[model samples]
Target: MIKIFRITAKNKILILGSNGQLGSHLSNDLAKLGEVTSLDRNGFNFENPESLDLIIKRLSPKFIINAAAFTNVDGAEDFEKIAYQVNALTVKKLAILAHENNAVLIHFSTDYVFDGLKEEPYLENDIARPISVYGNSKLEGENYINEICSKYLILRTSGVISKNEDNFISKIINLSNDRDELNIVSDQQSSLNFSGFISQAVLEILTELESNIDKEKRWGIYHLSGQEPGTWYEFAKFTQEISKKINPDSNFSKIDINPIPSTQFIQKAKRPKYSFLSSVKLKEDFGIELPNWKKSIIEVMENNE
Candidate 1:
């Protein structure tokens, strides 16, 4: 069993983007460490950036966990205003608030920050050259946290999945409902990280720090992602493989996943062909190594079934 950590005094932890895939899981897991005050789209909507000042001041949380952002890759091409508002402008406010309150700001970024041109997995020090609007906006948010806040942790991950949200796993399941065959992009390569894993890693980091605000080399951006790199085509086929193993009567066997190049599917935004991140630094600092993407697929399929 995973050894859960709980602080003695119950530090107040404010979670932004509580309605998101990662935010939903963080809400429950962070509760084990402290009092989690979750604010989703309905309450702490990033679309309304000006309102965050009052809320952060009122709460004065010891830790601010930002699990929210504008994640629509294609839509960001058309609606850049709201994308920058939510991903960049709002993040700036949260960083400032965390700085003023002397609280630790834990912000989530994307692997999309890198152009995916590198031959190897992305390192924390890699020069970020985003290929799309969404990626650029997310990188801007990371910059805000780095520039304004001293006590901060910026975690950059990719291909995040959750049993709760409409993620890649859920999409495959939903598409399998009616379609007998699916054409998934195979040219793109990246890591698939589960929300549960991401949440646990964050909790462990907090536990290690014990909400310490003192300056340390560990307080910086880290690439936290899956154990291995794979394409969407592989991820879908693996999901089918797991579904059949767990439940022989499942409909996953009936669906055929065909691998295709990115050109086959036209989209408004450009995605990096290789945007996966390296978890070496995360392991070096925190001694946390996430399981393979296949294991996460099995657990996700088990829950969905």
Candidate 2:
């Protein structure tokens, strides 16, 4: 039987990109464990990599959670250099700093790292064949973290949504409020991740690490995301359905959701057609499972309202 670990106030946690959807949730959830020094883009600029090194050295946090990234998928196609700098170069610097400080680095990655050609859910050791600049940059960041930091947890999640940020669900909600109908892609397939659930899982993993378990076995890349796989059309439809259920009289309740192919929804970035991540490794190691995407959507929608 695996023993659950408890967190103490002595564990100093530093959260980068604290203002983001996932970062915001992490800051709130992780605060219960210890002193959390949350930093948004303004607080710590990735433009200046040196600033990261300086801050990590000064704070000397026991746990450094990097939730920040250049997440503009289509924008990255035009600005690859900026994306690489923010996502890959800065991450490499953070890993180095974390290693020097003897801190456990917790970094967030994406399912986009995969080419999405595989029909089955991707495992942790799957070969990454990123098709877009954003995906490439994220893959590079993962590589740097794995090489530089001996004690690190790289969580590769998919389609992260939350009430606080402009994610897929929020976009659908906003669009439904204005438009009568929507064209959602039906080709793309992946699990939707809730930032709140991801944050909670991270905390639980931290607790396990804080315990006497062999840190080496636990420290590595793990696929953490929703259990159910779905297409963008289904995700949007469910969002609309749940929104209507939550607010029957709301304008969003009447909007029509139409399913379309990926070719019709042309974008600058080429997203993977199928990039679902399997959380079996995480469950086997930590004995934790993420909540269902449908349940998470309802909770987020209700909470935001």
Candidate 3:
């Protein structure tokens, strides 16, 4: 059953990491519901934890959506401490603040929390076994949120792609501009989520919360992603195909995609072989079905063009 929830105009909402790919979209969507106070990296520095208390105390927002994180997969390998500080320790502090203020904390988590040993898509209840420093740091953050925050929603997503930022899809598009041939990993498998779609889905949940429709059932982790699972190579090819149709004069039309094994690619951090998330729980609970990856890809490309 699909439920439409109404949000009051005066409710205050604070969004951290407002300049990020997902954060940017979320800020725009969330602004419609209530008063939105957005904070970029400069506004809320994770490195300086002491300053957070003053910001949270002063804002006194009813909801705090944290989209900030140290998301450099390869870079995390070289700087585990910085990753842990930003991803784990800072999340703990935020969780504490949210708890003290009786604010709902909506934190974004990654699919990398899983080890990718399972053939099937991961469920919200699946045991997390992270394989890299980046994954471990994210898992630690999740643990902190679970421990400290009673009113929280941990949304686990995978391969977040956006037209406005540097992600998997944008990287491929940029690379195609300069190179005729592109090599992408075929072994990695996950669902690619669009920032716009994700933000809309989140908006639905927030609306429900405002209406007090599903207040009791909303707190906890949920898997949100595109409908189908696909490999990196397949995603790149689809992007290329769509890009060619959208912009025939673009260099993406001339690019030849080459599939390569994960082992062939060298990187500082290890990625999960299969980390696709199942959005069945999210659909059943929120009554929102995520769009297909192809639809999202096409929409993003069309909007950017």
Candidate 4:
């Protein structure tokens, strides 16, 4: 059943996965809202769910933003058990804990939850059919949250990148420095979102939620991914283009990025050929429109320099 939540006593905001790129940004930005507590996943054990119950009860947060996730797409295929435990089961525990504590559980999800079968961008309520274990695990987590918690949000995003973390853009720059060319997967289509963008969006959502806590329409899954849709090849090429424009004298400007089919780039996991997410719901509901991939790439490239 859907239960509307209102923050009464404990107004602390707890941020999980404090070490990640998005988590780090969120930790810093959300502090302005209220008393913030940032917890790293390593500090607690997900294998034993009961251990977290004590910790969360002590924290007594009004808002629990869970960013900790097992995001290794390829590694999930090998460590399937651990992946499910960390991504799904642990998230289920979080939902239950938040429901008990009367806290709004804001969780981060992924575009991988949808298989790349549809040509159009995936929406919030679209039927999800994941192509990989990582996707399945994340979907399971979302399902648990939906079933267990009423005052919660599931923000589905794509490849979240930033200069502060070792993301795709940073990796592309590093590879270009070492190798003469980069062969990126062109057949796959998705968006590369900036961590800063996501953090800011979350901040806005938190502000709105705090102001009006009983709005049932505000709680649910929302797409907070990049506005622009492009293939990996396009992302890489844009990275090179921006890096070169930013630092023309650097080697980053000289390296070439080549496009190849997903088959050419062999991997244990199968990625969605198209998982570009549409943020119309987020904008329509929360009045937040995420920026384009090009702008985010430019910011990351400039920071790299």
Candidate 5:
């Protein structure tokens, strides 16, 4: 036995991109259960390759979870090189460093790795054929982690709605305060994963990893995300409807929601027509079940209040 509980006390964990929405929540959640050191743009810049290797060798954390990514979908189209540098190259470096230190690397990826043409939910083994630069870069990053890191866990999710300082949720909440109606895309379908929910999943992984520290073969990629799938428009309506309950006087519920196809919604980067991911594998292996979209919505709404 690896003395799982003991490792929790002795192990050092580092979280990259601690400033973003998902990162912020994950940092807070992980800190409660173990020793956690978080780095954001202020401390670590993915663009600067020099800092990455230095930090990894210096910290030698037992667990390294990278929440950092060039998330600007449209911006990625214009800054393809930067996207590759930050998304793919940095992850590769991190994986290499983690392997060298005998640490376990846990990375977050996106459902955008798929082309969205698939009629059903995407499985972990599905062939990744990205239609956009961001998606391709994310897929590349996943590959790097898989190839370089001896022990690793790559979680793929989509429609990540978090309460961090910056995210789609905060943006929607802000805009809802200003406008009565919001236009959201209904054609694209994907599951929504809240930051809080993801934090719980990470905790579970750490708990399991501590117990099986010696079981290196147990390490592999998994799908950690929400269960119920919905379109951007459907999610918006659910969000707005929930907001009205919190702010009864607010007219978010009254907002006119129009379901528009992906073609109608013009964007600099192309999104998968349907990138919904299935949580079957995660549930089977980890005994973890994803929360429903409505349940996640209520949780975020309540947290905001």
Candidate 6:
């Protein structure tokens, strides 16, 4: 039996980090379902707990989707405090608030929570051994939410790319425009996903939960990302090839892509060498299918063109 919440067509919803790439897409799709209150940087600062509390109280939303994170991988090494505050502390506070109000909270996480040493894809139940400050902080945040909030969904994904925002795709296009060749990390491996696709899936999950509360099969951490996994170099090469078709007249040099080891890429923080997550659980449990990395990239590029 499906247990439906007492929700009308006008249920108020709040989207934190509504200005981010994923958040932007989520906010747009969620608008189709109900009255969505989108909060961008100007309105929502994750560092301020009291302000966040007040915002949640004022909105009193039935669903709170947090898409914001201190995503600067390298920057997180130097700014661990800020990263923890935004990624871990804010999520903890949000979880508490959600539990208090009996509201469902959906949070986005990353594959960085794993050490990335395994040859096979990571499962949701796999041991998390984050190698960097960013990964550790995010894992802490996920743990806090699981410990504090009874009704929450934590989604852990990897290698996010989008055409509409300040992400890897745009950066590559912009950089390639100026320079003939670009060097992308080749050693690290994971799935690449579009922001729009992620948002759509989130909306589906939320709708399912709201419509069928008794559906015990509709909750928990689901690995949501691209299907086929590839190295960053392969992803970059595909991007360049795709861009050539989109901008034939543009003079871009065919630069040699060097596949270097993780040790070669010097950075403030360490990274998971293999962070690909297995989608078997999500597929088997939720009947959700993640598209292949190449297919997702092509679709996103074509959409932009």
Each candidate's lDDT (Cα)?
Answer: 0.86, 0.87, 0.87, 0.86, 0.81, 0.81
Model 4: residues >4 Å from true position, as ranges? 1-10
lDDT of 6 by residue, 12-56 (tens): 778888777788888789877777878876777888777877777
In candidate 3, which residue pairs get closer than 3 Å at backbone N, Cα or C atoms, i.e. clash? none
| Cα shift from native, residue 295, model 4 (Å) | 0.9
Candidate 4 residue-wise lDDT, 1-305, digit = tens: 11112234346888888878898888888877877778776666566666788878887888998988888899999999998998999999899999998999999999999888998999988899998999999999999999999999999999889876478877777777778788999988899888998999999999998987976567889999877899989998888787677788767688777889998999999999899999998988889988899988887777763
Ten-residue region with minimum lDDT total, candidate 3: 1-10
- lDDT, candidate 2, residue 161? 86
Write the residue-wise lDDT of candidate 1 on 250-290 in tens digits.
Answer: 56666778999999989899999998899899999989888
How many Å off is the CA of 294 in candidate 4?
0.6
Off by over 4 Å in 3: 1-8, 213-215
Model 3, position 232: C-alpha lDDT score? 93
Q: Tell me the tens digit of each residue's lDDT in model 2 across 138-255.
A: 9999999999989999999988888865788878877776787899999999988789999999999988887753445678999998788999998888887887777888777787
* lDDT of the structure predicted as candidate 6: 0.81
What does the lDDT come to for candidate 4?
0.86
Q: CA shift at 297, candidate 2, in angstroms? A: 1.0
TM-score for each predicted model, relative to the true structure: 0.94, 0.95, 0.95, 0.94, 0.92, 0.92
Whole-model lDDT, model 2: 0.87
Query: Which is the winner by lDDT between candidate 1 and candidate 6?
Result: 1
TM-score of 1: 0.94
Pick out the ten consecutive residues of candidate 5 with the lowest summed lDDT. Answer: 1-10
The residue-level lDDT of candidate 3 at 23 comes to 87
Clashes of 6: 0
Window of ten residues with lowest summed lDDT in model 2:
1-10
